[model samples]
Target chain A: MKSNTYKEYIAPVVVLVCICLVVTAALALVYGVTDPIIKKNSKATADKTRTELLKDADSFTEYKGKLVVEQPGAVYVKDVYVANNKAGFVATCVTKSFGGALTMMVGVDKEGKVTGVKVTNHADTPGLGTKDFEAGYLSQYKGIGELKATNVKDDGQIKFITGASVSGSAVHYGVYAALHQYKDMGGVK
Target chain B: MGKQSRLRILLNGLIKENPVLVLVLGTCPTLAVTTSVENGVGMGVSAMAVLVCSNIVISLLRNVIPDKVRIPCYIVVIAGFVTIVQLLLQAYVPALYASLGLFIPLIVVNCIILGRAEMFANKNTIFDSALDGIGMGLGFTFALFLMGSMRELLGNGTWLGIHVFDKFIPGMGIFNLAPGGFFSYAVIMAAVTYFAAKKGAK
Candidate 1:
């Protein structure tokens, strides 16, 4: 009975525990080596993106002001960064789309005019909803100073990609919220 | 197991017991990430790395691991290795890591890794098990590449982002969607099956 109990319970338990310990130690060792490199890569990507968006900006300073939260037309602003050279503000916004939340960055120059809009991350459906994210479709928002209404039907500022209106609206609203952030910040104060 | 030549064991995974084509393991990722050649190759290479590492470790522990808890032990080892791969990719190949996204973590549950652990690694020597992993990994990669090329070419009129027939013929947009994925998968599967049958008849 004693030997059977050991075989049935103790042996398996001890063996599993030992395997778990070794695996955990191995994971910790790899994590220690790679964690810093991962952090550095992401930071570098973010910096490069910001520079591309605001071409004249020498550097960016994260905006500490109250972030734009969920509202009627738009979702929420994820982050806002002010150009150190006073060129503009780059606002990251998350808005609802066909697939899920669509994250984008909108660059607004000092005159409250739009410089560029880029979708950074999105889960929009492939081939259908993704059509709205194409550069040609997003390029219409460039040089626009203000948005009285966010949707294409309301304002002719931005056109919707045919067969992907929901994703188009999501991209539109993302820029809407970003411009709102710029206005709220009173244009890079 | 020792009776079989090492070369045969390594090559078995290519066509005979190909994990994606013959065994039909890991169908989920096979369909989901094959929309583009880049994503397909990236996933295949990442999976191969994990498979080779896990098979060797599991074979080495086969004698010491108690039968009752072997499954759990295998999972822990596999998950650990998957996480290790994930970290390295995130660090060194951030673009691939971003494109793969959720699928990277999902590799932990991929049946091919666990299936090899249960079937080949437990019974075979470490060297042989490693060979099986390579063979199976290559088979999986080959299957994914074939599907990726077909879908990307017909669906998007491009291969690896280079436009193939955009000027003459517009891409059938449906090929990049779910229905297109299923269609391409079925066609490829049928071709592989037909070829295998002919080989067998001979």
Candidate 2:
């Protein structure tokens, strides 16, 4: 009876509970240290992208007022930055992409031409829709006077990624939305 | 019950019991990350670290773990090692952490780690268990690297994002797609099978 109680009831539970306690304690200790580093890494990446978007500008001053954009497929106009040297304005924007959401920075120069578009954060299908996020595709927005949805299939200039059309559309749409906000802020020039 | 040579135990996992090619385990990650050479190597090294650590831990505790709850205990232990690996990757190698995002967490469920713990670690000495983990991990790494190289070279005409073919011919776009991944995997699997069969015939 003692052996049965020890083997059947007490011992297995004790082992499992002990293992769980050790693992949980270990994970808690690790998370405490890594959380801060992860936060810093993400912040550094964001700062780098913002800088890239407005590379020529000496400084970028974010508009400290409420931003509300009621455009289709546009998530939000998260922030608007004006170049201190008056060279350009970069609007950080977000839109729903394939897997989750794509956040990008669209830079418009003094000529009202899109100087650059950079995808800052995204959770899209890796190879399919992600192809559109590449510089080759994103760079197509550079120097364009107006943000237009272009797909080679429709005889327009740009070609939507073959397999991930929805994701491709989302990125272009997000950039266009950011451009619209830039235009609202006195037409980039 | 009898003694097994350490070298034979180590070599057994490389080919005879290769986690990917022969044992046909952990195919999910093998396919998912093998899309690029860098990703494949990153994942392989990360998994190997977890595997070796878990093997040693499990072997050391083999006697104390109650038989009835050994599987659960093994999972908790493996998961601990996996989380540590993930945290280290995220903290120090954020580039790899970003590229391997989901796969890094998914290593917790990877059959190679759990299988080694159950089949080898629980029954073997710590040193031998570590060897098995390494051999199997390397074999898995080799299989993934070959797949990634073939796919990258053919699909993108590049190696590790550098232009390799230099417009010799436009890349076969399909190789970068899911169908391409499956096709390349099938080709590799067939080759491994064929060579293994020929060796067996001798």
Candidate 3:
């Protein structure tokens, strides 16, 4: 019985712990080698998306001053990039969609016109809320320089995606927040 | 196992005992990713890398791993490989990485990886275990591709996001949704099961 106990319990536990330690060491080495590459790739993608959203801008420079967010409620400006030649400003923004947070970059021109918007990260439900990030839904925001970002339900002229009011509203609020930051930083001038 | 039987062991994973169809394992990732062909391929290839690596490692350590703690030991090795694969994906193929997104990390929990590790890898030689991983992985990829192509063609009127059909009439929108995912999965599952049973009867 004592031998059985040793074999069944203590033996397995010892073997398993040794295996775990070895695996963990191996993983640490692989992670060390790959982590820098991963960091570089993330930066590359972020750069690519930022450039795509502000295509017409001659160049972009980071805006470090405080961004006044006129629109409150789940909207936030994570970073602001201003285009050279007073062209436009791109705001890396985030807001809550139906399923979760939607992170995007919104480019607004000096005339307060939206040049482009690209969703960088989102956890919205695939079919239900993610459709909001597609070209058809996002195109509505582009060049809608007239009204301050207001929900279409409030008669702001922009039509929210059908059956996905929360997701649509998230983008609307993100754009609204971006514009307020742009104005505060002399982007419209 | 003889050379011919060894060949049979590898072939077993591809169709006769396909992880996705015959065994009907790891159906969630299969269904969720088949919305688009690209996503399916990305998920399949990633899982394949992790599976092959983990399988070989487990097989090598099979004797050393005690039976009582085998499950935990297998999990640690599998998860380690998965994290490495994910890191590689994130670093090198950022596009594929983005498309696969949350599913990449979720691959750690995928039953097929641990299932193969426990069933085939621990019992087999290193070369055979590696072959099993490759065959199972390919079978999974093939199944996912078929489901993705059918769904994409019907649901979006596109193949790999290219608008191939429905220039006029819209495609079946339902195929892209959750219910559509289930219907597609069930239809394919039924087809495979039926054919396998027929072969058995014959």
Candidate 4:
């Protein structure tokens, strides 16, 4: 009776072990096949965004060490990326919005003008705050002449999306920071 | 299980016992991935593939697993399948994989896979369990596609990457935002529930 019980239990254990081994091998095979594709796609996405912000640049290189760019009335830069010939720089900036942290990439021309801005990530309230990033509103930054945080009435002054004050301010701060970084790099006018 | 009765069991999961709507078993993916039709379909198909494959393996091994360690053993089995699905999505369907994001990994925790493993697969014949899995998976996919279509249409004025209502409507972009998802989901859920209740009443 004891021998029979042992044999019965051992049989199931062997079967279980075999099944697990096979399943693991299969998963490993699939993972091996797909890992490279995922990595490639991620790189492509980053490159696309970088290109959109620095259209005139031939190449871009990440600036190492701590570099802060600040115009007289703008925010500070968290990091900087210099494009070819110092024509412009991309800076990372963050601000508090209604939903959560709003992060944006701000591009500034050599003359300290706002060249472009892209909201890289944000948790802002979707409909109200998110619209601030819509092409119509964001495109206004294309030729913004200079970084002036307090000149709210200037035609080139940052415009707030009526209902999304927090999100608007976040983008405003981000752009301001980028302008400051550009000037500090001696690339701003 | 009777041969004919086995078919009934399979059909029952497709509609009467749907993992998404009827059973409300996998709400996380249902809510998270249904933002667009493409994403919803991608996630649905990936999950179905994993579920069906796992169910087959689980059923075949049921007799071998000791009851005490069955739950843990089942989890390992399910996780293995989930990873395989994740990798496949990442490779061949990069766009869909990006849209699905972490949700693909979250499939490991989806109750539908584990629930079927515990309830249907463990005790059933291999063929029957496989059918049950396919049926339930299809039901979940159908639900996701319906939700995705509504959200995409209302949120972005587009469907399946095509701008269908663009010519007919101006300023129809409100639906593409986040609040639109909530409103659309509520309306669709209410409608499905009402029809389901009405059918039951008859």
Candidate 5:
């Protein structure tokens, strides 16, 4: 009678253990299969962003987490793109936002003038903050030299989109930080 | 377990026992990810797949499982299916995966999955449990889609990224913010409750 009870208890335990093992093995298999694809997709997105931000530049290099153009005597412009006769580098700034993160790729020439600013990613209030990306607003950053974070009335100012104060500040700070990085890398503005 | 009653099992999820509106289960994904129709649909479908498969498996093994260890066993089964859904989404529908983010992994903890396991799967036969799973999944999907549409329309003036009211309406971008999410959910719940009450008055 004791053996019968023991068998009854041990049988269920064995079955449960077996089930747990099988389920875990299946999960491992699925994770293994998808891991490669996820890595590839992430790389693709990064490459695309690099291409867009580095347009018109011959070659690009990553130095200290910033993409630097392979141009000679590149000057860093604060919120500006500086280009000479030959080649130039642009500063792309990224910042964390409400939803995800925001990336602004600012193209600078050898002359320390702003070529353009493109918003790469933004999860801001869809309509309001997203308007910051629209050409009408973003275009204002073009050809700007020595851009800085200040109110609209302040010097080296960029227009802030109405109802998107946080995003506006984030973009401003991103640009300023990128410019600082460029200056540290011997690019003058 | 009755063959004739299987239909009622499925129908219960759609109306009287709706997971989102009636039962108020799985509100995290329902509220957090329903900012857009595409995300809402993707999450809903993924959850449905996990729910149906897990429910069927649990029901089939119900008699074999000891009463003491039933909760842990149910969780393992549910987590197994959730992992499958998460991997599939990451591989085939990467965009959805990016949008859903951590919520995909959080599915393992979603109360709806556990609640269904305890309430229906533990007691019911496999067929009835499967039908219940499908019904509840659909109900959840319906609620998500409804909320997503409302939020997207007001926030971005679009549906599934397509401009719906470009000429006439000015999109209230605040609707896309977190506050907008809460407002939309409350309004939707109120409307659903109002209609449910009217129907019951008869």
Candidate 6:
């Protein structure tokens, strides 16, 4: 009877615990080796993205101020980097889009004008939601000082893709959040 | 089961017990990642790595593991291998990692690995189980490659990002959608079934 109980309960428990320990040990070994390389790769990508968005800036330092944007879950500021050359401030903002969160970088100059805009990561629908993210569409944000309204229907400053309003407005709000973050920081201070 | 030779065990997964086309396991990643050849191949190879590793470990531990908690043991082992593959991909091959995205982590739940662990690995010797892993992995990869080629070629008018039919035949946009995935999967499944049936009759 004791042997039966051991087989039914104790044996399984011991086996499972041992398996868990071995798996965890293996995972920790792999993670320790790969973590640094992953971090380096992402940092390199971020640096490259920063240079692309703010062409004239030679270097950037992350803005130290706390981001206090009160927008809902759909839009929020991720990070803001200030250009040392006074070119502009690059703001990374994530906004809810068609498929999922759309993360984009918007560079705003000291004069409160958009220098450039680039999408960093997004799960937006390909072909449809991506229509708004085209170089032609995103380029319109360049030289525009500020947005007056939330979407294309209200704000004539930006022209949206005909069938992708959700994505378009998502991007519009992303840019809005970035610009708002820039304004809140009061330029390169 | 013991009567089967090593070569037959290895080759069995290619057609008779194919995880994707014949058995129709892991349809989620099979459909989701096959939109592009690059993504499809990437996902296939990644999943194959996990499957092979998990099968070997599960086979080795089959005798030691208690039958009552074997499923949970298999899951922990499979999930461990998946994370290991995920980390390695992120560190070494960032491009493939980025393209594959959420599907990488989703491999943890892939039924093929668990199915093999339960069905083949536990019953077989270590060498035979490893061969099964390789055979099944190759079959899964081959299936994804075929589906990815068809979808990428028809939908994007390109093969592996190279412009193939673009100059002559315009891209069929529907082939890039979810419906297209199901359509292609069904068509290929029917063809495989037809040939498989013919072979069985012979």
TM values, all candidates: 0.86, 0.84, 0.85, 0.66, 0.69, 0.86
lDDT of 5 by residue, A53-165 (tens): 54665555444444433222222222323333325565556565555566667666555566566775555533355556666777776666665443332434776755566
* Regions of candidate 3 where Cα sits further than 4 Å from its true position: A1-6, A68-75, A97-101, A123-131, A135-137, A146-172, A183-189, B99-102
DockQ of structure 5:
0.26
Please provide, for model 2 over B25-72, each residue's C-alpha lDDT reduced to its tens digit, 9 standing for 90 to 100.
898877777767877777787788789899999999999898999999
Stretches off by above 4 angstroms in model 6 are A68-74, A97-102, A111-115, A119-172, A186-189, B1-4, B92-96, B99-102, B167-169
lDDT of 4 by residue, B10-99 (tens): 778666777877787887667766767887787787778778888998999888788766887898899887777767776788676655
CA lDDT, candidate 6, residue A19: 91
Q: In order, how many clashes per candidate?
A: 0, 0, 0, 7, 16, 0
Q: Which portions of model 4 show Cα errors greater than 4 Å?
A: A1-41, A65-80, A91-106, A117-180, B1-10, B33-39, B149-202
**What is candidate 1's lDDT per residue for B21-135, written digit by digit as tens?**
8888998878877877876887788788889999999999999999988999999999998888888888888887777654667578789999999999999989899998999
lDDT per residue as tens, model 4, A1-189? 887776668755765687689888888787777778777875676567767887876677888755663332234565677776767767777655565666677777676777778876565423345668776778777877565662333325666655455566667666666665665667632
Model 6 chain A, poorest ten-residue lDDT window?
Answer: A122-131
Off by over 4 Å in 5: A1-21, A58-176, B1-4, B76-80, B92-103, B155-157, B162-174, B177-183
Tell me the alpha-carbon RMSD of every candidate.
Answer: 3.5, 3.5, 3.3, 6.5, 6.7, 3.4
lDDT of 4 at A114: 72
Look at candidate 1 and tell me the lDDT of residue A80. 87
CAPRI quality band, candidate 4: acceptable
Candidates' C-alpha lDDT: 0.83, 0.79, 0.80, 0.72, 0.70, 0.84
Residue pairs clashing, model 2: none
DockQ-based class of model 2: acceptable
Per-model interface RMSD values are 3.4, 2.6, 2.8, 5.8, 5.1, 3.3
Q: After superposition, how far is residue A65 of candidate 5 from its true place, in Å?
A: 8.8
> What does candidate 3's lDDT look like per residue over A63-87, in tens digits?
8789655435456898887877667
| Residue B52 accuracy (lDDT) in model 6 | 86
TM-score: model 3 vs. ground truth = 0.85
User: Candidate 6 A-chain TM?
Assistant: 0.80
